[model samples]
Target chain A: MKRMSMTMVIVLLLIPMALFARGVSEDVTTLTIAGRDGAYGDAMELAIQSYTAKNPNVRFELLKLSGSELMEQSVIELRGGTGAFDVILIDDPFLTQLQEAGWLADLDALYRKKGVAIDPDLVENMVNIGRYPYPNGPLYALPHVGNVALFAYRQDVSRKYGIEKFDTWSQVLDVAKKIKANEPGMAPILFRGVQGNPIVTGFLPIYWAFGADILKDGKPAFDTPEALNALEYFLELAKYAPQGVTAYQATQVSDALLSGVGAIAIEVWPGWIGNLENPELSNVVGKVKIAAHPGEVKRSSSMIGAWMVAIPKDSKNIDAAFDFLLHLTSAETQAMISEKNGVPPTRHSVHKISSLVAMYPWYPAQLDGQISGSIRPRTNYWAEIESVFGDYLQRALVGNLTAKAALEQIQRRVTEIIER
Target chain B: MRNRERAVYSSFFYIVFAPALLIILLLTTYPMVTILYDSFFRYSFVVNTRTFVGLGNYIHIVGEELFQRSLINTLVFTLVASFSEVVLGVALAFLLKRQFLGKRVASLIVIFPMIISTMVICAVWQIFYHYEIGLFNHVLTTLGMQRVGWLTDQRVALASIILVDLWQWTPFAFLIIQAGMGSIPSEIFEAAQIDGARSGQIAVKVTLPILRNQILLVLMLRTLDTFRLFDKVYALTGGGPANATQTLSFFIYREGFKFFNFGRASAASVITLVGVAFLALFYVRRLLGEEE
Candidate 1:
C-alpha cells in the first residue's frame, strides 16, 4: 500500500511537469531581438505587435537597449556564438566590423531561399551600407533607421542676414559672424562639441565638405590640408556658439534650435528633430529650414548615420527573423511607423507618402540626403579612429590644441590604431 | 574523541566553505588571470582575432598619450575627491556628535545624497552645472558675477566632477565617522571636560585620535571608489572639454567595450589593478599598524 501511494504521488508530479514542458514546446516560436531604445524601441514594439497579431503562433522577446549597451551585448553574444539573440540592430558604422567578422547571417542566401529580391523602394545608398564592401557585397543587414546628418538654419535669420543660400562653409561662417555681431543674445551657431561620437559626427559633414577623407587609400588622412582647413573653419564657427557648447548633446542643440535661440545648427539628425515641427513644442516651428550640408571644396556631403537590422549568424530561427525583418522594413510598416513614431523611413515610397511628407516637411531633403549621403569609411577600427579624432578635435575646439596640432595628433593616433 | 570531533568539524567547515572559495576563485581570480593572459596578446573582439605579442599591448598602451593622461586624471580625481569627502565627512560627524534637536532629521538629510542613485545625482548636477541655465550660473549672474564653464572648461571640469563626488559621497564618510563616534564612551568626553579640555582640544587631541581607524577606513574606501570614476564623467562631460575627466575606468570602457580592443583594454586594466592594489596595500598596512 505504501509503495502504491508513493507511485501515485510521483505520477501526479510528473503529470504537471509534462504539461509544463509541453506548454513551452507548443507551437509558440518566440523571436528574440536585440534592438535600440527610444524612438527605435517604440517602432520595434509596434512592428512586433502587428507581426504577432497576424501570426498567432509567433511571440517576441525584445531587448531594447541604448546604442552602447546594444553594441557591447551584441558583440559579446555574437563573438561567443551564443545564439542568444535572433536579430540585432547595428549602427551603420559598426555594421562594417560585424560583417567583416562574419558575425551576421548571409541575407542574400536567405533572400534566394525565399525567392525574393531586395525591394527597389529602399534607398540604394541606405541599403548599400548594410553590405560589407563599399557598394556591392553580400547583404548582411537592412536599413531600418534612414538617418542622415543634415544642417538646420533659422530661415528668418538667414533672410534677415541677406543670405539667399548657404552654398559654402565659408558663407555659413560669414553668416554666423554677421548673426553673432547683430544678435548678441542669440547663439549664431550650434553643434555637439562633446567628445567622442557626438563631436566626431558633428564635424564629419564639414570635414567631407572641405574635401577631407577620414581614410584616404586605407590610411589616416587627417594630416591633409583639407582636414586642417575644416578644423580651422569649425573653430571660427565655434566663436559664435554658446559658452557651454562643448557640453552640448542632441538635446541641447534641439532645444536651442526649437527655442529660437540659435541661428544655425551644424549637425541635426532626423531623430533629434522629430518634434521640431510640433508647434506646441517648438517656438521656431515654421522658421527653421532643414537641408543637406553645404559644400566647401566638394559638393554637399551629408553623413549617413542609418541604423541597420541584421540576423546573427548563430540565430536559431533565421527564417523567422528574416520574415520579421522584411515586414519591419516594408513600405506599409515604414509608413505606419513614420506617421506614428516619426522614425525616418528607409523606403523612398514611405518618404514620399503625402501624409508623412506633410507631417515631416523635410522629407524631401531627407530622401535626397539618403540618396547622396556619404557613409564613414568601412574600417574595423572606426570606433577607435573616431574616438582619437574626436578627442583631438574637441581639444582644438576648447583651445587646448591648435587646429594643426590637433589634426597632426589625430593622424598619428589613427595611424597607430590602423597599424595595430 | 576530541580528535574525532575535530575531524568532523573540519569536514563541516570544508563542506561549508569550499563552494564559496570555488565561486570566489572563479569570479575574481579567473577574470584576473584571463586579463593578464589577454594583455600579452593583440586581441580584437570585433574581428575575433587574437595574436600573441608578448608585452606588445602594454608597451603600446603605455606609450599612448591618452592612456597616460587618463591615469594622471584618475589619480588626481582619486586624491582630491577622496580626501575632500573624508575631511568633510569628519567635520560633519563632529558637528553632529552633540545632543541637539532635529538631529535625526539632520542625519537623514545628510545621508540623502549618498542614498540616491549615482546616475540620478549626475543628472541633477548636470543641470546645476549648465553654463547658461544652471543653478550655479543663475546665482552667479544674479550676484552680477561672471558665469563659469563648470563642465565646458577643461581646467574646471574635473574639479566640477570632484565637487559632485564630494556632494554624493561625503555623507558615506560622515556615516562611518558618526558610527565610530557613537561607539566611543560618553564618559571619555565627561572626563576630558572635568580635566578642563575645551571642545576644540578634546576633538583634536582625543576624538580625532580615537577616530583615526574609521577615518583611514573611509579614506581607503573612498580612494578605491573614486579611482574608478566613470559614470559621472560619462553622463556629465563624457570625459570631454578636452578629456580632463577621462578616468582609467572610462579609458578601459572605451577601449574594451566601445572599440573592442581587448588587448589594449586588458593591459590598461592590469595597470589599473596594480595601482589600486598598491594603494590598498598602503592603506591596509597603515590600518594594520594602527590595530597593532
Candidate 2:
C-alpha cells in the first residue's frame, strides 16, 4: 500500500510539469488565421499545409467562416482590442471601410521592416484596392482571390441563334430570345436572384453598359434615362428566364449550366465557373465559351470582386502573419492551391501555367476580364445603395411596380442615404 | 454565542447571490443602456467616429421611406402571424387531445418542422414557394389554375413569409397548448357532461376557459418573437419584390451589423424595444390584474 501511494504521488507531481512545458511551447509558435469558407477556405488550407510542411514546429488555427461572418467578427474582435487573429480575410467591398478604420496594418511598413516588396506578378489594380484613399494609397492588404465577373455562353447554342459576336446588350437579348425559341428546355439566360450581392453584381454589367453610373460626385446617379432603359431591357429579357428566376442564387445558376438547362449565364464569377470544364462534374464540358460582358454605350464592363488578406492593426504576431501572407501569395503556393483546391488564381503567371489553363479553358477570358474590369463605386454607402437598388429592381422584375416607379422609389431612398 | 455563525452564513448567501445578480444586471441592462446612449450619436463605423447629435438618427430613421415601410411590415407581420399561430395551435391541440389510430405518427409529423434549423427550413420552403417549378405552383397548375407569383408579388411576399413562419412554429404553440390541456382533469369534463352539456358546449364553457391563460401566454410569446422576423426575409425574399417584407430586425441588421452605423441601428432598435416593451407590460399587467 505504501509503495502504490508513493508511485501515485510521483505521477501526479510530473503531470503538472509536463503540462507547463506543452503550454509554453504552444504560446510561441501557433498562428491564427481568419479566412473565408467555400473555395477560398480550400485555398487557405492548401497554403497552410504547404507552410507547415516547410516549418514543422510552426502551426496554424484557421477559422473558415462565411463572408459576412468573417467581416463582422474581424471588426468586432479588432475593435474590442483582442489580438486574437493574426491574419484576416476581407471582401473587396469592405476593404475601404477596413482601411479607413485602420483595422488593417500598413503592409508598406511591414515590407520596409522586412526589407522585401510585394511580388510584381500581382496586378497593380488588385493591389491598389488594398489601400486607403485608393490608387496611390498606403498598402494595407494583398489580393488573395482575383474574382472578376465574366459572361458565359454555349458555343453550339450561340451558333444556332446565329449570334456571332455579342457587342451590345441588345444583341445579347436578341440572342437570348432566339435561344429560348429554338431550344425548348434550355433557359436562354440565368442570373443570381438571391438578393443583395448576387442580384446587384448580376445587374452591374447591364447598368454600366447602359451608360449609367452608380455614383456621380458622391451622389446616386441611378435616376437617369439610361438607367430606366436598362431596367426595361432587363425586364424584357426576363420573359425568357426560368419561372423561379427571382429566387435563383449562385447554386441554381451553376446547376442550370451544369445540367444543360441554361444556354447563357449573364454573370459567372471565377469561383463558380472553375469546375465547368471538368467532364465528370459537368454535362456541357468543353462546349461553353466564356468572355467579358458585351459592351453597348462603352467598352466591355467587367466587375472585380477581389477578396484580400489583411493583418488587423491589433495583431500580436504581425511579423509571422506577413510571413504567412507572403507564402500564401507566392507563385508556387498559388499554383498548388489552383491544382488542389480550385481557388481561382489572382496572379497573371498562374493563368499561364499549362495545368491550370487545361483545368479552366476560360482562364484567358477571366484574365482579360480582370485586366479591364470596372470595380463598383467605392463609396462608403455602397452597401446601402446596393440594397436599395436591388430591392426596387426586383420589385420591377416581379411586376410589383413599373420601371419608372421603381427607379423613382430607389432614387428617393438613396438620396436620403447619400445625403446623410 | 451563535451570532457570529449567523453572520458568516449571511455573508455566504450574499457572496453566492451577488455574482448572479451582477451578471443578470449587466446582461439585461448593459445593452439597453448602450443602445440608448448610441441613439444620440452620429456614428460612422468606417471613420470609427461618434458624435453627439440628439434625435438626429431618430429623425433620419423615422423619415426614411425604407424604415417607415419596414415598421409597417413588422407590425402587420407580428399581429397576423401571432394570432394565426395561436388559433391554429389551439385548434390542433384540441383535435390532438383524444386518442386515435396513427396518433403517434401524426404527433411526430406535426412537431417535425420545429426540430429543424430555421435556415434549413427556409431553404426547403423557398423551393416550395418558387414560381416556376415549386411544389405550391405545381399543385395549382395541376388543378388548372393560374400560377400565382408567391414570393415575387410585393402584395403577397410578406404574407408568404408569414405562411412559412406559421408552418415552422405552429407546432411550438401546439405543444404548449397541449401541455396546458393535459393539466385539466378528465373529471372536469365529466362533470360538465354529467350536467347535460354537449361536447361543443363543454369545450366553449369549460375547456376554453381553462385554456385561456395558455392561449394568451402563447400569443404574447409569439407576438414578441414574430415582431423581430429576419431570417425568413433574408433567405427567401430578402425584403425584395419591393420593401414588402422588411422587418425591424432586418433594418437593424443592415444599419448595425452590415453597415456598422451604430447610431441609426441603435435608434431603430430602441424604437422596436419600446414597442415590444409596451406590449409585454400590457400583457403582464393584465395577468397581474387577473390575479388581483
Candidate 3:
C-alpha cells in the first residue's frame, strides 16, 4: 500500500512537470515586456490591446512597475544573465547607467542584424536620450515617453494678477506673492516636495534659470553664488506656497492643481497632468496653461525625463523582443496613446498630428520642450549628489538652514562625491 | 581501539551534517565573503569595472557627514527601540498571564501586528503620520494644538519611525515571554504566595528571575532585527529631511542599488557585519552565563 501511494505521488509531480512543459514557446509567440507603472503602464496596455488584435498569435506579459523597482530588477536579472525578460523599460536617468554598464543590448547592432535602419517617426531628440554620451552616441534603447518639466498656471488668474508675460522666475514669484495675498484660501504656488527625484526635478528649472549649473566643467559647483542665489529665490517663492508643501508628491500637487485649490504649479509633467482638460478629471477646465518654464538668468530650461525601452543584454528572445519594441514605439501607437490616454508621445510628427493637438493643447509646447530640454547630469554619482542637494535644499526651504549655509554644506559634500 | 571508535563517531557526524553545512556555506558565508572582498575595491555597476582601493571606499563613506549621522541615528534607534520593546513586552505578557474576561481575544489582538507584514504596517502608519491629512495631526488639531510634521521634521522623523517599529514588534517579544512564563511550573509562584509575599515582591523575585533568560533572548533577537531597519525608512520617508533617518542598511542600498557603487556598499556592509557580530558575541556571553 505504501509503495503504491509513493508511486501515485511521483506521478502527480510528473503531471505538473508535463503541464510546465506546455508553457514552451511556439515558433511565433508572445513577447514579454517589463515596463513602468502609472500612465506609462496604461499607455503600454492600450497599445498592446490594439497590437494584439492585428497579430493574434503574439501575446504579451507586460510587467508594470515603478521607475526604481523596474531598474533594480532589470539590473539584477541582466547581471545574472537570466533571459526571462524579453524587453525592458528604463527611466532616462538610468539610461546613462545601464547603457554605460553594457547591460542593454545595442539597438543599432540589433537593427543591423535585422537588416533594418530603425523606426523613423520617433523624434530625434527623444531617440537620442536612449544613447550613451547622449545626443550623438551609440543607441542602446528607444525613447518610449517624452516627458519634460513644464510650468502650469491658472491663465485667467495670471491675467488678473497682472502677470501678462511670464518670462522669468522673478515674475512668477512676484505674481505668486500677490495671488497669495489677494486670492483668499487658495495656494498661490505648488510643486513636488518629496525628496530624491521629485524635489530635485522640481527645483532644477529654477536653478538653471538662475544660471546655476548642477555641474560645472564635469565637477560639482553647488557652492557658488549663483546656486546660493537660486536656492534663496526658491525659498522666497516657497513663502507663498501651500502649507504642508514640504510633503507634497506628484499626486498631491496634481490633486491641488486639478481641484482648483492652487494657482501655479512650478513643475508639471505630461503624464500626471494628462487629464487637465477633461471635465471628468479636472474641476477647472481650460483654465490652466501648460507651457515651458519661465526663464530667469538663462533661457527657458526644461528638464527631459524620457522613458526608454531596451532589450536586456541577456535576452533569449531578442528578435521577438525587438518586434514588440518596434510595435510599442510606432507612430500609430504613439498617436493612439496621445489621443486616447494622453500618454505623451516622443515623436514630433505624432505631436504635430491634428487630432492629437486637438486633444492635448500642450503638444506644440511639449514638442518644443522635448527638442530643447536639458538632460540631468549623467554622472554615476547623480543619485547621491541629487539626494544630498535635495535634502539641504529642503532644509533651506523649511527654514532649518539659511540658503547660504545649505549651499555651502551641499557644495562640500557634492564635491566629495564628484571627487570620489 | 578507542581512537578508532572516536574517529568513526566524528565521520558519522560529519556525514550527517555535510549537506546542511554546505547550504549554509553557499547561502550565508559566500555572500559575506563576497561583500568583504568587494569592500577593498571601487566597484561600479555602471562601469562593471572594479579597481582596488585598499579602504578608499571606507574612507570616503566615513568622510561623508550623512554616513556618520546615519550611524549615530541607527545606533540610537537600535538601543532605544529594542530596550523598550523587551521591557514593555515583558510587562504586557505578565499582565495577560491570568484568566481574564476575554483572554483569548485579547491575546489574539496583541499578536495581531506580528502576523501583519511590515510594509502594510508602514502604509497604515504613514497615513497616521501625515502632517495635514493624517490621524495623528488631526488629533492634535482637534485638541487645539499646532500640527506636527511627524515624518518631515529631522528631529522627530527617526523617532516617529521608531514608534512604528515598537508598535509592530512589541507583540513579538510579548509572545515569547508569555510562552516562557507558561512553561514555568505554577507551584513556584503558589509557594511564593503561601509565604505571604506581595505581588510586587513575587514579580521582582520569582517572575523576573524565571523570565530573565527569555528577556535576554528577546533583547538579542530584537537588537539584531532592529539594526537592519531599511523598509520603514524606504516606504515612509526615503531617509529624507537631511539624512535624519538614514540607517546603515539604507546607506548600503543607496550606494549599492541606486548608485551601483558596490564597493562602497560592500564597505558599509562590512562595517554593519562587524557591529552585528559584536552584538552576537555579547549575547552569546549572556546566554552562556545564564545556561551555567
Candidate 4:
C-alpha cells in the first residue's frame, strides 16, 4: 500500500509537467488544418508539401472535408474552444457568420506582428470577401479558391448555327431552342438542378442578369417584378434541360458538358470544367467556350463563390498557420498549385500567366469575373435564405408552384428568417 | 445472522451495479435532459446565445408547413417501407424454407443487399433511377413506353426511395423470420398434411399463427429502423425534388447542423423521441403480453 501511494504520487506529479510541455509545444509545432476535399484538397496538399520541405520542424494534420462538413465541424470545434483546427477553410457566404461570431483570428494583427504587408498580387475584391463587415472590416481570411460562376457552351455548335455572340438571355434561349430542334441527341441546356446550394448557385447568375436581387437595403427582394421575370425565364430555359435536370448536380452537369451531350450550361464553375481542354478527359476538346454569363436587363452577373482560409481564434499554432497561409496564397505557390491541380488561383499574377491562360482559355474571363462579379448577399442569414429560396425555386421548376407563387413564398420565409 | 447475510448481499449488488448504472445515466439521461431543457429556448449554437422562449420554438416548428409535410412524409415512409419489407420478407422466408436446389447460395444471394453499404446501394439505384439514360428508362423506351422521372417528379420520388429501402432491408427481416420458421417442428406440418389440410390453409391457419410473435418482432424492428431513415435520402435525393423525401431526421439535421438553430432542432428531436418512445412502448407491451 505504501509503494502504491508513492507510485500514484509520481504519476500525478508527471501529469501537470506533461501538460506544461504540451502547452509549450502546441504554439510552435504541428499545425492542424481543416480544409476542403477534391481539387482544393490537392492544392492544399501541394502547399503543405512545399511548406514542410522548407520548414522540417513544422508538421501538419490536414482534414480534407466536404463543404458542409467543414462548416459544421468548424462551428462545433470553434464554439467549444477546442483548439482542434489551427486553420480552416470557409465558404464565402458562411465566412460572414464565422467572422461575426469572432471565431477567426485577426489576420491584420498577425501581419503586423510578422512585419509584413498584405500582398497586392491577391485579388483585392476576393480579399475583401474575408472582411467581417465585408470589403471594409478588418481581414480575417485570405482567398484560397478563386471560384466564380461562368457560362459554358459549345463554340462549334454556336458557329454552326451562325449565332456568333451571346449578348442577352433571349439570344441564348433562341439558340437553345434551335439546338433542341436540330440535334435531338444533345441536351441544349444544363445546370445543377438539385436543391439547396447547387440549385441556388446555378440560378444566381441568371437571377442577377435579369436585374433581380436577393436582398436590398437589408430587406428581402424576392417579391420584385425583376425577380419574377428571372424565375419565369429560368423556368422557360429549364424546359430545354435534360429530363433528369432536377437531379443534376455538378458531376452530372460536368459530365454532360465534357461528353459533348450538352450544348450549353447557363452556369459552370471554374473547377468543374478544368478538363474541358484535356483531350484524354474530354470529348468536347476545343469545342466548348467558357465566358461570363450573357446579359439580360443587366450586364453579365458572375456570382463570386471564393473559398477563404483563416486561422481559427482558438488555434494554438496561430503564427505558424499565418506563415503557411501567406505561402499558400503567394504568387509562385498559387501558380504551381494551379498548374498541377487545376485550382483557380486568387493571385492576379497567377491568373495572368500565359501558359495557364493558354491551357484554360478562360483565365481572362475568370479574372474579369473575380474583379467585378457580385457576391451573394452579405448577411449572417444567407444560408437560411438560400435554403428557403432553393426549396421554393425547385418547387416551381417541378411545376408544384408557379414562379410568382414561389417568389412570394420565398419572400415570406426570408422575412421570417431575417427577423428571427 | 440472517440480517448480516442480507446486508452483505445488498452491498455486493450495489458494488456491481453502480458503475454501469452511472454510465447509462451519463450516456442517455444527460443528453436527453439537456435536449428537453434546450427545446424551450431560442438558441444559436454558433454565437452561443440562448433566450428562454417558453414553447415558442415548439409552437413555431409544429406550425411550419415544411415540418408538417416532413412529418407526413416520414410517417408514410415508415409505414409503407416497414409493412412492405415485412410482407416481402415473410414471402421470401417461406419460399426459401423448403428444401430446394442451391439452398446455401440462394440464402447468400437473399442476404446480399443487407450486407452491402447503404451509400453503394444508393449509388447503384441512383444510376438506375436516372431519368434520361437510366436502365429503367432505357427499358421503358425500348418497350415503347414514356420515360418516367423516378426521382425528379415529387409524386414518384418518395415511392422510388421506399422501393430502394424495401430492397435493402427486406433481407434483414427475412433472416429473422427464417430463423423463427426453422425452429418449428417438422411433425407439425406432417400432422397438418395427414389431417387433409391444404398447403395454403396450413400456411394461413397453422404456420402464420405460430409465427405471430416472430412477425410482430420483425415488424417492430423494421418500424423502428425505418423511422430513422436518413443516409439513403441524404445520398440519393438530399431531401429534395421539393422536400418530398424529407424525413423527421433530415428535418432536424437541416435545422440543427445546416442552420445551427439548436433550439428548433431540439424541439424537433424531442418530438421525434416522443413518437419513437410511443412506438417502442406499444411493441414492448405487445411482446411482453405475449410472453405473459
Model 1 over residues B1-292: C-alpha lDDT tens digits? 9999999999999999999999999999999999999999999887778999999998888888888899999999999999999999999998998879999999999999998999999999999999889999999999999999999999999999999999999999999999999999999999999999999999999999999999999999999998888999988888888988898999999989999989989999999999999999999999999889
Q: Model 4 Cα displacement at B273 (Å)?
A: 0.8
Model 1 ranges off by over 4 Å: A1-24, B1-16
Q: For model 4, what is the C-alpha lDDT against the true structure?
A: 0.93
lDDT accuracy of residue B107 in candidate 4: 94
Report, in order, each candidate's fnat. 1.00, 0.61, 0.57, 0.86
- Which residue window of length 10 is worst by lDDT in model 2 chain A? A192-201
Each candidate's chain A: what TM-score?
0.96, 0.95, 0.92, 0.94
Worst 10 residues of 3 chain A by lDDT: A21-30
lDDT of 2 by residue, B1-292 (tens): 5999999999999999999989998999999999999999988766779999999999988988779999999999999999999999989998988899999899999999989999999889888887777899899999999887788777788999999999988999999999999999999999998999998898889999888788888988998899889999988887775677888999999899888899999999999999999989887777667668
Clashes of each: 0, 0, 0, 0
Please name the candidate that would achieve the greatest lDDT relative to the true structure: 4
* Candidate 3 residue pairs in backbone clash: none
* Model 4 CA lDDT for position A276: 93
Q: What lDDT does model 2 reach?
A: 0.86
Worst 10 residues of 3 chain B by lDDT: B236-245
**Comparing to the true complex, what docking class would candidate 1 get?**
high
- Two-chain complex of model 4, DockQ on C-alpha atoms against the true structure: 0.75
lDDT of 1 by residue, A1-420 (tens): 999999999999999999999997787888999999999999999999888889878889999999999999999999999899998999988888888888999999999999999999999988888887757998999999999899999989899878767889898998998887898799999999898899999999999999888987898899998999989989988998999989999999999999999889999999889888899999988889998899989999888899999999999999999999999999888988988899999888998889788889889989999998898889888888988998999999989899999999998888988987
Kindly report the docking quality category of candidate 2.
Answer: medium
Give the alpha carbon lDDT tens digit for every residue of A130-160 in model 2: 8887778899889888888998888888887
B1-292 in candidate 3: lDDT tens per residue? 9999999999999999999999999999999999999999987766778899998989988877778988998999999999999988999998998888999999999999889998999989989987768998999999999988888887788899999999999999999999999998989989999999998998899999998889999999999999998999999888876677889999999888887889999999999999999998999799988899
Docking quality class, candidate 3: medium
